[model samples]
Target: MTATRQLEGKIAWITGGGSGIGAATARALAEAGAHAVVSGRRAAELDRVAADIRAQGGQADTLPLDVADAGAVADAGAQIAATHGAVDILVASAGINVPNRAFAELDTASWDRIVAVNLSGVMYAVSAVLPGMRTAGDGLVVIVSSWVGRHAVKLGGPAYNATKHGLVALGHSLNMEECANGIRACVVMPGEVATDILAKRAAPPPPEELARLLDPSDVARMIRAVCEMPARACVNEILISPAWNRNFIAPGEAAPRPARAAT
Candidate 1:
């Protein structure tokens, strides 16, 4: 009567999973049969997600962590392994466009803030999980990236652009370097998802414009695809955007639209 979980018996760890794409992917992975560990700085939020998964009869655990801290990431990795086994899937979705201002307007402090979390934090996450994967003889690393990584677009600041671009290169390098070891690395670049990213960037959604953007569920489905895949076939990069789009728009002009009353 119950649907079979796609990743049954596999363990997964999702970073920046308090909300948005990471949170959505966490739920999707659990539905796919993975025992998912959702980690983030907010314990309460992660706990809520974990509880929901449990209520759905899926296995889940929460780890309150800051991926920017390598030590904490490593420790969390160990804890998850001890609790559910070595992770078969790792989703590096924890990031933000800190001080989302123009490149010239970005001071060194703001630049470092974005780089530390989006770039360095991903490194820490991958490194922390590698040992377990190596011991197990296989692993999958999924990095949630952005179209900005492919080619520059609006809101493309120095820090955000740099990290997104670097992630593609990182994913490729990992795939090639670890292919023989049965480790698959992939980057999911999704655009204009319905998530807190705009707010995180202090760019509010346009009530009218919100309808055109991609939803987090779309991105989550991509992550699920990567996670459910066999190591034999690797999806290197997924460049997704709003089915409809404009080259550019004012920051505030991207908000959601109000529903129309029926005539």
Candidate 2:
């Protein structure tokens, strides 16, 4: 017998679903029986993902809009609710980072752009869907944060670190306020996932190195696991890292190992 699809008939709205972790998660959710609505700024990319999902016999639709535009996000949310009767899940994964820029070197415009999309954009999406969630009496929200939020990493710019750190706090506050209303919130902190974002790095990793990094599909599986959990339980946060931590070693240097296993 086949396992029952846990999210059958549920509606999932994922921002940044055009690519990276968001796109992977959308596909996973669709496979699990949710009607996945993917939204992103790239119309072509969004259409590609949606089309792929449909080809795989999954339910999907695409919405093209910039998350940085609050009005547009709100309008899209309203339209989704009107058409789909309120989204049952929301995965906020839209993010960007400027590489090789420190606090002293980063410009005001770049900082503003990062904050607009990574921080305020998350808040905007949350604002858009909360009313419907409140009306429905239950919902799930997954915030795709970064390990930089919990620990400082020099490679990620100050703006990226600051906004991601803020997202962790945002997730907690959201749960604190909405738990009574049956809104479950989770923050996923991923370390060095191999995705297009890496292309923005000052020195992009070669294909061989990128191959060792965590796949977006890995994170997508985690998202599905969190969503499939019983309503009585909610995983508040998770940190996922690739076993081979590229950042832990310098280029062309051999990784050190312990002489013996410690208890």
Clashes of each: 12, 0
Q: Please give, for residues 1-263, the per-residue lDDT of candidate 2 as tens digits.
A: 13357999999999999999999999999988899999999999999999988888889999888999999999999999989989899999999988756877899989999999999999999999999999888999999999898887988888999999999999999999999999999999999999999999888888877888899999999999998988778899999998888767777754456589677
TM-score of every prediction relative to native: 0.91, 0.94
What is the alpha-carbon lDDT for the whole of candidate 2? 0.91
What is the alpha-carbon lDDT of model 1 when measured against the actual structure?
0.84
| Model 2 weakest lDDT span, ten residues long | 249-258
| C-alpha lDDT of residue 117 in model 1 | 88
Task: Compare the candidates by lDDT and give the number of the best one.
Answer: 2
RMSD of each: 4.3, 2.5
| Candidate 1 Cα RMSD (Å) | 4.3
User: What value does the lDDT take at residue 125 in candidate 1?
Assistant: 91
lDDT of 1 by residue, 125-215 (tens): 9998898898888999999888888877757677788899999899999998988888999998887777777766656656566668888
